[model samples]
Structures are given as C-alpha cells and as structure tokens.
Target: MKLVDVGGRTMAYHRAGAGPALVFLHGGWSDGRAWGPQLAGLSDGFDVIAWDAPGCGGSDDPPREMTMADYADAVAALVAELGVEAAHLCGISWGGGLALAVWQHHPELVRSLILVGAYAGWKGSLPPEEVEARVRRLLAEAERPPAEWMDAYLPTFFAGAPPAGSLELVRSMMLDSRPGGLVPMLTAFADADLNAVLPTIAVPTLLLWGEHDDRSPVGTVAQALRSAIPAAELVVLPGVGHEVNLEAPEAFTTEVRRFLQAAGATLIRVSRATCALCGQQAASEDVPLTWMTSVEDGRKRLYCDRCARENVRSIEGKLDPVYW
Candidate 1:
C-alpha cells in the first residue's frame, strides 16, 4: 500500500506484481479494498493497482461539489503519478462512469476499458425522473448514521446472503466514508450524459455486468452501452448483482483476464531511469515521480516529481532544462 497526494488531497492505493498496469477503480461508497480479490487474483500476470478514491478508505474527503472532469483528472493524475505510460482501465458502477470520463479527457493514457455494471452517467443513461430519484436516494443514504447506514445499505449490494465477514468489510468501508461526500460524488452524473462519447472510444472495451443487477440492470444499461460503443462486448454473470467482483471474484478475474489477453495486454517492465542528482534508479515511467533530472555539464537529467517540486523555483529559472 502507498499514498499519493493528488490536488492537495491524499489517495491510498495498493499495487502488486509486474507487467502492463491494470488499474482498478472501485464504485461509490466503496474503496479500493473492494477489489481485494481481483488485486490478488490478477497480480500474477499484471501490475494491478487499486486506489482508494477520494472520500473513501484512507483517502482524503472530497471537495465540495466534485464533477466528472474533476474525478477523471484525479484518476489521470493517479495513473501518471505511478509512471505508467498507458494502462488498461477497469471500473465498477460509478467507477465505470469515471473511467469513461478519463477516456474522454485522457484517451492517450488508456489502452482499453473494462466496465462492469457501468453507466454513461445517471443523467446521461436514465430518464430525468429516474436520475432525480437516484440522486435523492443517495442523498438520503448519506444522511444515515454510521451504524444505521451500514445496516440499511449493506444488503442491497448482493442479491443473496454474502459470505461471513464480507458484509462487514463492505459496511465498514462505506461507513468510513465522509458523509458529506455522498451528495456531490453521487450527483456528479446527474447532469452528465456520456452517450455521445461512446462511439468515439478507439480502445478495446469490455462491458461486463451482473445478470441480476438491479442497481444498473444489465438488459437496459448494458445493452445501451454495447449498442453505443463501437464494437463493445458485453458479458452477463448470472445470479450476480451490483457487486459482481466481490460476489464472483474468480469468475470476474477469469473474464477480465481473457478480455485483456485477447487485447494483447500484459504487465511488462518499462524503460528504466536513473536520477542524475542522487543516482537512484527506477523504471523510466516511474521517473518524474520518484526521481528527477539535472544537467551538471551538457547531459539530460531526471528527478522525482516530489523532489522536483521542492526545487520548482530553481528549476523554473533553468536556461534550457524545463520542468514537466
């Protein structure tokens, strides 16, 4: 586990294994830990990184009225901070929507997209009344006290009884979230409609959903996404609900691995970089973050994003070497 500061707020993430990075974005009310199963299951073949989105887990609370672009940029920064050039993006529910936003803003950084029980955005995918109703529901949910919120919200996540401790794990994560986060985070999609952006996505996309998903029913949402996104494929997991990854992790991993494999993506070592100042070494992709450059004579130098920031003033005055 590691933490990075994005836009002044901190985000906690878990990274494992090596290869093409597969970034997992968890859904609303949940944190990166929601992908625990996938992180462990997929780490062997890919560089899996799951982050605690703002307002959940150990991450900082959300700023007032965060928007889709805000969420997307934060994710982009998180990915850039990791030093990966491009990655296969996977998101669940709201995370799926955020992933779409990332695609719209940072297409160059995404190699492919794996969206599970996703949406274009409530405002974009659902009728006006439905969107309002959903927003109201989330707002009401945010009003509940921690214990009551846990008890009331936990059951709806799964179609059937969850294994022992599973419910507790989810409950704790949801309840741990800052109450003020729900309204803005949930309502961000209220005015967004990503329908037009679907056809423009040039990367490979896999839309996986739970057959029994009442939260974002597959027949309606999945079909709509499939029809809109060019050549996008959909897979429905029978008996699974909104928490498809948590409910059928093994199956989810199998499906995603197959999708990514077919798309010819796997974690591979990136070019390496050596800091000119401290002589520290890291993958070139991880540079700018963990290491930085300096030119003592006439050679190019590399430095860390952090250390570079500290010397931003001096770096700004450079004659030719510029800060990125």
Candidate 2:
C-alpha cells in the first residue's frame, strides 16, 4: 500500500512491477483490492497500479458535493505525483465512467483506455426511468446492512454461479463501504453523460464486456460506445457478467495483456518515426507524437511535440504537412 496527497486528500494505491504505467480503477462498491489478480498477474510485464478512489478503501471520503471533474483532477494529480507521465487507464463499471472523465479532462496524461462493462454514464446510455431506479436502489442499499443486500446483489454480479471464494471476496469489499463515499460517487456516476466526449478521443481504446452483463449490457451500452469511439475494439467474454475480472480473471488478463502489448508496439513505432516537418527524432517512446492520416494514401504520418504544437489547427484539419 502506498499513499499520496492529491488536492489535500490522502489517496492510497497498490503498485507492483515496473514498465509503462497501467493503472486500474475498480467498479463502484469496490476498492483497489478488487484488482488483485490484475495487479499481481500483469506486474511481471508492466507497472500495475490500482488505486482506492476518494471515499473508497483507505482513502478519505469525498465531500457530498463532489463532482466528476473533481474525481478526474484527483486522478490526474495522483498519476503526476507517481512520476508517471502517462498511463493506460483500465476501469470497470463506474470506474470506467471515471476513466472516460479523466480522458475527457486530461487527454495528455492518458496513453490508452481499457473499459470493462463500462458506461457513457447512465444518462448517456440508459433510459431515464432505469437510471433513476438504479440510483434509488443503490442509495437504499447504502443505508441497509451489507449482509441484507449482498445476497441479492451477488446473484446479479455474475452470469451464473460465482467461482469458489468469489462471493466472499465481493462481500468483504462491499462491507467496507460507507454511505458518505457511496452516495456522492454513485451520484456523480448517474449524473454523468460523456457521450459528447466519445468522438473526440484519439488514443487507442479497448472495450471488454461480458456477453451476459446485466448491469451494462454489451448489446446496448457496449455497442453504443464502440460506435462512438474512433477505432475502438470490443471483446466479449462468454459466460461472464458485470464482474468480468472476478468471474473470468484469466481471460480478462489475457485480453488486457495482448491489447497493451500491441499498443506498446505502436508507441515504439511512433518513437522511431522522424518528424515530417522538423526532421527531429523523439527522445524516447514516452515522448508525445501526433499522428495524422495521410489524406491521399491514408498512411499515418508523425509529428514531434514542437511541430505538432506549432501547427495544431492544420493537423486538426488534416491538411497535408507539406502545405504547412
């Protein structure tokens, strides 16, 4: 367990291994420990950091009035404090919403995105009536004894039966929840509608969803996201549910590892690319590279940070670099 101060709040995170930063954001009612399999399993090949968001796990409770922007800023601050220039953000459920918020606000700090059983926020994806009902149910659950709700909630968490000890694992994590944290975090989730931010995302994105996910069904929510984000890839884990990582950890880990390795290779290619405008070489793979599809041949062309900044408009317009 490691701690950092972000915006005067104490944030706790579990980190392992060393390489390109791969930060995990868990679903609502869960904490960083929810990512235990990922943190330990993927650490061998990449730096894996799982954080207990404000009001969850070892972190301090956020104010009742906390908004999505506040959550996004705290995440960006935490990553910067850890000396990670950019990270591949992997989030599930509500955490996936937070990941989208982070990318919407801090695009420069994100390398790629991995969203599992995610939402474009309830408002962005679900019917208004359904969103309200879910919000009310969650709020009521926060007020009840953990045991009373766990039995009912546990059934919905998985597609069919849970793996041995999986039910206990989820129960223990939910027992640690408090209303102060739960209400505000979930409220932010319900209110968020990041549909507008989807088309603007330029980074590589991988969407993992359970084929039988009840909470965020792949057909509606996942397909909507896939259609919205540019070049996004979707992988459905058969016989899984919203808790895809818990029920199918091996398959989940494999998909994530393959996606990240491929994304890393693209970064390596970007590192080797000479700036078409300035003929300058990138200092490292981490250096930012702006890639534009050639209007004529559709091949990707690279520009270094300086040249990219100087002609941002031209690049946005997809005008040929030769003309710039």
TM-score of each: 0.79, 0.83
Instruction: Give one digit per residue, the lDDT tens place, for model 2 in 1-324.
Output: 788888788999999999999999988888999998888789998999999989899998988987788888888888889999779999999889999999877766677899999998888889999999989998888878777786677767899786787777899988988888788888888898999777656667899999999999999999999988867889999999999999999999999999998876442222234565787765655565566544544434556667656744333454222111
Compose the digit string of candidate 1's lDDT tens values, residues 1-324. Answer: 689887688888999989999999888888888888888999999999998877777778788788989888888888888898679999999999989998877765677899999999988778788998877877776677666656665556787776666677788777677666556678787778888777656567899998888878888889999887765789998888889898888899999999999867432222333333554555434233222223343322345555556542233333222112
Off by over 4 Å in 2: 267-324
Clashes of 2: 0
Overall lDDT per candidate, in order of appearance? 0.76, 0.82
Q: For model 2, where is the 10-residue window of minimal lDDT?
A: 315-324
Against the true structure, candidate 1 reaches a TM-score of 0.79
Spell out the clash pairs found in candidate 2.
none
